[model samples]
Target chain A: MSIKFKHVSYVYAPATPFEQKGLDDVSFELKENQFIALIGHTGSGKSTLMQHFNALLQPSSGEIALAGHRITPTTKQRDLKTLRQQVSLVFQFPEAQLFESTVLADIAFGPKNFGYTDAEAKKLALKWLEKVGLPKSIANKSPFELSGGQMRRVAIAGVMAYEPAILCLDEPAAGLDPKGRHMMLELFKAYQARGHTVILVTHNMDDVADYADDVLVMEHGRLLRHTTPSEVFKDRAWLLKHGLGQPAASEFAAQLAENGLPLLPQPLTLTALTHRLVAHFKGGE
Target chain B: MTKIIIGRYIPGSALIYKFDARGKLLVTFLFVFAIFLANNWPTYLVATLYTGLAIMGTGLRAHVFWDGVKPMVLLILFTSALQLFFSTGGTVYFHWWGLWLTSTGIVNAIFIFLRFTLIILISTVMTVTTQPLAISDAMEWLLTPLKWVGVPVAQLALVMSIALRFVPTLFDETLKIMNAQKARGADFNSGGLIKRSKAIAPLIIPLFISSLEIAVDLATAMEARGYQGTSGRTRYRVLSWQKYDLLNAGAFVVLLILLKVLG
Candidate 1:
């Protein structure tokens, strides 16, 4: 197993008036190279669960085994250093974490921290900068001077430069325009295509339908469901009751079926929905 | 993390919470002054009991008070220990290797500890009972006289309030940066003093940059909302003195006079 959480739970500010249950008896397993989408409403403990993957947070109860490291409440901080190098998390608004003087230096910061030499780090930074679609000429400028989208790209490149075996992102495409969002999602998909695990926490069901292979649904700090996107989105009424929206294609397919225009199966993606409609029209002809 | 009670206002319906922020601020100042004025054991005991009563009156939990005192435990102990060994007076209770533990030393240490505890407890009670905005408003009102002398009192108060408000926000930002760096294999623990300080550079730089960005954003937002830097602003929540505020102030003066007479 690449990642396994066995009855894990977490509480924030335990034993105080502000104490809150952030995660409740969550248990799941994720295999290697799987593109997993973690979906939940705000404050549903999605971020808290993702932080456990890299040992940024330890489970308050039970245990988690990620890439062979068994993490419990008593895990030593020193043991997490290697785990962090293997599982990198790109937090929300990660661009704000850029602090190096130049864009190149900022991108190289991660690789260098992970033991890459100056020249090697810079080389990797240059490679990833281009891969993230930024020009080499802007590498020497301050990241703060860049536009919002460019800064996000630079920040993402910084994490990608280190190239962890498992990548976890929290709302990576949030606040981006459609094009930027598409580019970001495509970049992550490409990363997963290279045989690496990608765990994405996002609210966009369309992105889930198009990209994610497996889906983990969270509700009120509990793991309500863990299945494929097709399976999870198929239960439209259940998803709606849980305050989750279905993919547009699936909802439209459901409406069409309700109107007596039957599709063979629910189409989750635009291409699948289009193919189904074309076949229906040909059959009518 | 829960132990961080400073700058956090706990809501309550106690008399202390009901008193005006201005009256509370003045009383806090006077209380701190009264603490320093207590040089004898009797006076320190009275101050400690009074501060304890004041803390209980605020309706804050006992542990919250202990949380504030917890960090200062070591300092208090160290100071008391120094006084216990070095202070020379009264009958010697025990004689050790070139050191005498005397009655006066014991009394002095206890007096010092009680004084420190009382002062810290008073301040903690004030901060916990009064909201930060109320404190800032009180500060602005108290500093209004400085405007005649050309001090930007309103601006200063605004800056103070903003800074106070961002304390928790910046704390969270620091945690986020630290987590980001840690994910990159930066170890904050397990290092020498210099190494750890160097590791902190990653956290501090991001924090400073992000704080500047947040400041710029806040300024833009304020201007967008037509904040004229106190020149043309009208009060939304105006502060008015109540009868309890006068009673509270009167009670503090009475306590001060009583302490003087008894001590």
Candidate 2:
């Protein structure tokens, strides 16, 4: 289902001496099966905005509609719990949230809290672990014993076990090696393949360019632009002004274009860049 | 949901800071004991004046010194009222509803209240003047002798230091969780006790989960650094008692004896 926020505003430590306005009249919508990437500099309210998607953060003065149901402070407990389950959130460092004795138990925590039977929860856990490319053998071991990447995989498995319609990941590939990062992105691609709506919050422009179907650029608690990757990349000056780095491959293409080579459309990936260069030499004939 | 309070200890280079932590600890204990022993007006007056001067010497404001007294206000008032009604052996001021207020009772209440206020104020001075890490370091060093008795003093101090560090982090996390739950239409404010408590359930679940994560990260960091229960570890920061500490301790003891003799 789609998630909608109408004019959301949030403040950290409201009315206290430490109070800081984190979001200012922000509004956006995530349509069903849409893969959106939220990118901004640190403390630009990107995290604050993403938190609102899963109902982790409430707007100080706006309304939210999840799956066509109006979300309010007086919403029923059962309804809120179900809403949270539908929009699963895997935090930036998922491994930090591991607490149960075994990977299986940690994965089952969310489902069990929502009243899943033990046996049923275990079955779901096993399936999600495999879905994340981890084996069932890792299920019974303490989550603490797993390597960093494995821990993250199990943590994602825990969220995937809930089978949310909307999967919101906060910096999923953060702190991973290059290979680990690629594997994690591939997992999100698989999730998208299954027709699940994914909202990925990241700072890496390359990740956004390679995977994000929709890109929303935020700067200083303000949404500067919300459009497709091509549209966002077209505004090169604006992106640079807001502390956002351009995709490395696209930067190279732009440099080539400056050197009297017309690369019609800048390529963001290395493979596409290679193809474009080959065509330029062939087209020279 | 651990109702943790922030620790006092401002870090700065000052004369009071250079003193050994063990010396400071010993001196504080002696000062508190001496303050408690002052029985009469002259002794109490002298103790209060000395403490007030010492508080000013620390370069902290009077407000900082008074913070310790704030939390004990209710207890001080209660104890005063109890003394005014229950203490006997003096001229009676009034009698009503099985309660008697005597002249001695009034004196006792005033004395006890002043004593409570002054002592709390002095302790507040200690907390504000010393850095918490420094104090913990001092505590660990002083308790090293207890290692022979299998006392995990260093470990205890490490736990305290870590807990203190985590307080602000956890508080920020708690606020985030609360706001998130609130966004989902969970009313933490404007509800009955049960309803408010119920509303906090979702927030607490995530907060606890995050805390577990924090604990694991901290443990991993500790393990990575070769921490294995503080055995045979040489401290980077060493503390030493100086001549000033010896004089300070002796002066305090002499002052206590003088007060007792005069009383």
Candidate 3:
């Protein structure tokens, strides 16, 4: 397994007046190169769970094994650097983390911090900059000078430059235009294709349907379900009862089946729905 | 991380919470001044009892009050220890190398310690009971006379209120930045003094930039809403001098006078 969480629980400000249960008895495992989508309502501990993968937060109880490193509540600080270097986390609005004088330097920050020479780190940053679709001309410009979307891409490139073994992202495409969101999703998919584990926490069910291989549903600090998108979205009533919605295509296809169209095997992605409808019409003719 | 109780007003309907912010401010000022007038054990005892009563009247849990006093405990101890070892008067209890532990020194230590504790407690009670908005309003009203002498009292009050409001917000932002940097393999805890200071760049630069962005956005929002810095503005919640406010102020004044007479 690339990552394993065993009965992990995290409490913020434990033993204090503001103590909060961020995650409770959460256990799961992910294999190498698997694309997992974490779906939940706001404050449902999705971010809290993701932070554990890189040891940014230690589980208050239980343990987590990520990329061969074991993390528990008493995990030492010196040992966490290896875990962090192996599993990179791109936070919500990752653009907020960019702080170097230039875009190139900003992207090079992670690599250099992980023990790369200055020149090698800049080279890796330049390569990832192109991978994230940012032009090289802007590499010399200050990151503060870039647009919000462009700055976000630079921040993502900064993390990707280090080439972590397991990449975890929290709403990586939030507040982006449709094209930007599509490009980001495709970039993450490509990263996974290169044999790295990818865990994504997002509210967009369409992206989840299109990209996620496994769906982990979280609610009220607990893992409500861990299944494939096809299986999870098939139980529309159960998902709705839990205050979650199915993918747009899946819901639309379900409505068609209820109205006597009978698209057995509900379609999740738009392309799948279109193919199913085209086959139905062709078979009818 | 328990919301940093400093300068925070817990919402409640206790008698202390019901008192006007202006009255609380005036009483807190008088209480701080009265702390210095307390010279002997009896006066300090009365002062400490008054503080305890004031805190009790707020109906806040004893622990909440203790949490406020917790950080100052070390400082109080240090100040009292300094007085105990240094102040030279009365019958000497112990003679050490270049230091005298006398009965008067011990008394002086107790008096100074009680004075510090009483001042902190009174200020904490005032802040915990009164909202920042109310404090700003009371401040502007109290400082209105300064406006006659060309001081921008209203603007100053607004600045103070905004600063108070951002304390919790910036604290959260700092935590977020620290976590984000940690996720990127930035080890803040393991490094030495120089390495630790160097590691602060990632945390501080983002915080500074985000704060600037937030300030700009707030300024734009205020300008859009026609904020003109106290020019031709009317109060939404005007401060009124109520009966309880009068009582609260009168009670504190009487207590101070009694302490003075008794001391």
Q: Per-residue lDDT of B206-225 in model 2, one digit per residue for the tens?
A: 68878887899989998999
DockQ each: 0.48, 0.12, 0.54
Interface CA RMSD of each prediction in angstroms: 2.9, 7.7, 2.6
TM-score for chain B of each model, two decimals = 0.80, 0.82, 0.84
What would the TM-score be for candidate 2 when compared with the true structure? 0.72
List ranges where model 1 is wrong by over 4 Å.
A257-262, B1-8, B11-13, B34-48, B61-63, B66-116, B242-247, B260-263
Task: State the displacement of the C-alpha of residue B7, model 1, in Å, after optimal TM-score superposition.
Answer: 1.9
Candidate lDDT values, in order: 0.88, 0.76, 0.88
Best by DockQ: 3
What DockQ does model 3 achieve? 0.54
State the local distance difference test value for candidate 3.
0.88
List, residue by residue over A84-112, the lDDT tens digit for candidate 1.
87899999989877888899999999899
